[model samples]
Target: MHYFSQSFNYDHSWARVVIGMWHKYPNPHCSHVVTVDVVDRTVDPRTGIIRTERILGCKQRAPIWIVKLFGGSEDAFVREISFVDPSTQTTTISSVNLSLSQFATCNEMIRYSPAPGGRTAFHQTAEIETRMNMWRSAADKLENWLALRFEQNAQLGKVGFTDVLRQLWEDAKDKPAHVSA
Candidate 1:
């Protein structure tokens, strides 16, 4: 919710803060946190020539947060910047996954999950639009948050972010990590 850091010197080397959330551990690469387009994110089905996408790291329109839902899991992981409430001067240091998967059941989970509200029974009702509105509300807020970060980063130069954090290992490490809040 609130994050800040003092180690940055202003001479940022990386251009963008592109992140890749994975379902595996013991990261083979030396960097658990890859540079934004510091590398590529393509997996060729034939040659396996991984290529990094430009503007992959920190970008003006990209989502600072991403939500991933693996097929076999019921947990949600949120990847987002921990910024000091609305000041926008400095920034939250690391990419954190605020594990919000402790709700008792799937239905209950949906009730509390950070998904955009949408019609649950799409076929049999007119509330579908309303449900979608809820879902859209979350996305809209997330987009706004990301845009603010992009603007902040643009002012300082490129540095995926001001602070890099290690918050994913805490609660939802084993479950599907959802970064969008």
Candidate 2:
């Protein structure tokens, strides 16, 4: 299985600020931003694990309530990005794990669910919460570090959609004439 792990330490209340901001604007860049909206954002205050299906203030686009809470793993994914706000500090962690065989179909990752063999939601909720916490802590540290570097650089900004399209177009531009598209 392939996995991506990262942790970051935010200065002062940076973690809270970032987490709050992310919860508001999950997709900072409009580039890959589809109609992806936060139809809901409820969380368990005690554990910081999400509780409701959708956060009340989340502004999801019409339809598609079947949002994905997590994605990417070999054993039926549930990658959650969690931010823990302690009294003195906050931590943000994000991780991605996946199988070797699911490489090409990775984008269709939502299909990878823990509800295998007809498992009920009650059984899976606790498991998902546990997994969310694991990844959340890791993401907190990784994001904190990233935020610090970005702060030091002070030049990082959201990457736009055109950048992705341009890269793809450029790569295709060099295609052989025999392999015309």
Highest lDDT, which number? 2
lDDT on C-alpha atoms for all candidate structures: 0.26, 0.28
**TM-score, model 2 to reference:** 0.27
lDDT of 1 by residue, 1-181 (tens): 2122222232221111112222212233222223332222445565533333222221122322343411222233333222221222222222322232221111100000111231011010000111132366554554444344423533342222223313332343454434443
Give the Å error, residue 169, model 2. Answer: 37
11 in model 2: Cα distance from truth in Å? 8.9
Candidate 2 local distance difference test against the native: 0.28
21-130 in candidate 2: lDDT tens per residue?
Answer: 33332334431222332333566667664422222121222212112222322122213344344442333333232221122111111101113332211100110112
Q: Residue 85 in model 2: shift from native, Å? A: 2.2
